[model samples]
Target: MKRKCPKVKSLLLRLLLFRQTRPVFTEEEKTEFTRLYDRIIQDGGIAPYDSSYPKFRFLQYLSVTKPLLFHGSNYQGIEEFEPRRQTLFDGTYTDAVFSSADGIWPLFYAVLDRSGLTGNIRNGCIVSRRGERFYFFSLSVESEDRYPWTEGMIYVLPRDSFRQASEGKLYFDEWVSEKPVKPLFRLKVSPEDFVFLSRTTWHRSTEPLFKTYLLYKWRSKFGKRK
Candidate 1:
């Protein structure tokens, strides 16, 4: 029997592999960042719930660890819920991974089997250059419940201009003109569908909605090269 593809699923498969390459941060910087990260964990007072799983209680203990990154200063306009942090790579940033390692991309696999209702809101910006771009990919699987619309967007700017904006020094009047180009495409994944899409063409998410227990994973060269 031929399996049918959901609207979002089909679109994602077609776009996942396309990406624009850009300069990445140096290894030394990444190492230093990791070192600071460890100190944050220790000073933040994150108690060891189960030593077997060093990061088992991250989501439950995020408030104590929020000091590692500057508050609303370094990277502008990105918001993360408790238990999440902005991770710097090269010069770009993303939500930190709880347990990312070699051969493992940050992957979130959630099973929503409860009857109660819950949702997640994700908002952020994607900065790309004329020749530099980023690819944001996501895959979702649904159960009997329906899947919600997930929003994604992207913004492009001059290399020098982006640097200023990231440092919270960009004048609002000037930065407003640097909004991202309209998305190349948008689609919906359903219970019967498995979807994957890439924003490598310059896009970002604008408070997308996802049902509880949704399964998610983030894969990048950082995970592969390590």
Candidate 2:
């Protein structure tokens, strides 16, 4: 199968142009965060991003990675999450355990460029049991301005699945099975700024109201794409 090359320009635009830098929490502020983490774990598991009208079952697994910090600072910003994996057998496809390695941590922010459509979707993340590993699917939409036509939905699939989708062996429509097609709540963000959680979700930005930027450490595996 021909491997799909990463859409460098689009990825860079989302990471460097639309992302907003989050404020670093101070050590004193971390006290509350620690408490919140403990409280969440104590309450069985943190509810899925949306629970009011749950369509998918998303339970919190332990956090395995730490937060990504800003350059030359002790301040921590973005966090990484580790989810439980599962195995599956499609009958047609050889039975295999599906799992996703946590990608490099990311810093998320959004721009309010007001040049295109802005919307949200619910059940943004999906997980399927496939044995000892789990298959993950994540999606997000980006709104952009005129130049490169910046708006579209992004789907992140397990590595193998991503390859298949890119090869045309698997169609994106059939591959993605999301309930509550649109997000229940809209994230009010300016074209200049947006927020993101690095670990569990895949996100994108459109309608470039303002230039968005992202700062993150490079991983050897993914290379220096940005």
Candidate 3:
């Protein structure tokens, strides 16, 4: 039997499992979100954009360099969780201000629901261990690049690429290099839109003005079961 190509496998998995949708934000709500986003940025809510090595503090339980691992298969198996990663990004709010439950949770959840993963909102974050996967959420703004007229560019490495990096098959740096990598997902997103991502999906944004609707980790429900 021929072995499946990793890039092809990744694309198939994304097509079968991943879902992306733009949430419907009312005119008034959009205005409010924009206002809040701007306030956060002015107060230094944005992070410095590093085209080379992009780092984001997603939550208190996540680590910038390490990948989260879980035991068991997605359908039926044992369950365990590593703590989430939390490192402050360049323009992110200080813990004191960011931890508040007021601003973005409601809006974010509304958008996440559009992507078909509904969960309770709590403490400015959401973690759902519905079964074998983890559902995480965060807020981000797009970045402004000075050269190449690149504004709000986000680079994402597929799950397979990340796996290679983790297993020493490929250096993480080379995997994330700016050179165009085929079968990769690249986009210029707007702050008005909410995006859902996977934890294993390596992604980087340019400056500040983007929103991260959700980050999930699990064998997608659509994956073939063993």
Candidate 4:
């Protein structure tokens, strides 16, 4: 018999120990979820859970490990929550796909299963010139702006602006541009919830006051994508 690695054994143990705090979705609840799911894709994002989400205990435990760091000067003031073993959050803008084959996979998989919906869980990738990818990562800010505990905000760019960037007509030297353009949307969320945005969406976060988790890119086949 082949012996399992230590990491695999630890993951399996965690999976068995972790338990869901809420009951699974009911048929009626699933229908309502479907309605909400439709609206999220149309708006280019969705929050699958609210502050009332009961899985915080397990998520918090999962976040105890050291976080991955982004060496880029642009990401200097940010503190990340991506664990060392998780390669998807390496801080590069590189494009790629990941599998739900690890222990962390169930964290997202449970969310998807709870939704009773089908879609591709596209992880982080390069923000394509033609607006072709979506991403996921959890982060917090270490700057003075976060004097008290306050959740950061996300500023989303309009599709047209994204197109301009894609076409090389515009450039974002920073995470966001102060050049006044109507915001496509703005979001403020807690780690208790998960959010997913579309390829055409351009976003940046304000100072995060505490450690947070981000799970994104539920690209539905019936929805839109590259």
Best by lDDT: 4
- Clash count, candidate 1: 14
Tell me the whole-model lDDT of each prediction, alpha carbons only.
Answer: 0.24, 0.23, 0.24, 0.27
Model 4 lDDT on a 0 to 1 scale:
0.27
Q: What is candidate 3's local distance difference test score?
A: 0.24
Q: Which digits, one per residue and each the tens of the lDDT, describe model 4 over residues 1-226?
A: 2244534533432332222222244455545545643454367432343323233222222222211101111111222212122233333342221221111222332222212222222223222223222224221222212221223323223322111112221112112122333332233333223333111111123422121111122222123222
Q: 1-226, model 1: which lDDT tens digit per residue?
A: 2233333433442243333233343455444435544554454322222222122122212212232111111112323213233434333444332221100011111111223324322212222332222223332222214443222211111122112323221111111112222211111112121112221111112223332101122233222210
lDDT of 2 by residue, 1-226 (tens): 2344333333443443222222244454354445543554344221222222111111111112222111010112212212223222222432322222221111111221224435421111111121111112122344222321222211112232211211222211112111112111111122122122222222353423222123222211233222
Error of 1 at 205 (Å): 23
TM-score of 3: 0.21
C-alpha lDDT (0 to 100) for residue 82 of candidate 2: 26
**Best prediction by TM-score:** 4
Q: How far off is residue 3 in model 2, in Å? A: 20
Q: Cα deviation of 106 in candidate 3 (Å)?
A: 19
Alpha-carbon shift of residue 189 in model 3 (angstroms): 20
lDDT value for candidate 1?
Answer: 0.24
TM-score of 1: 0.19
TM-score of model 4 (CA atoms)? 0.26
Order of quality (lDDT): 4, 1, 3, 2
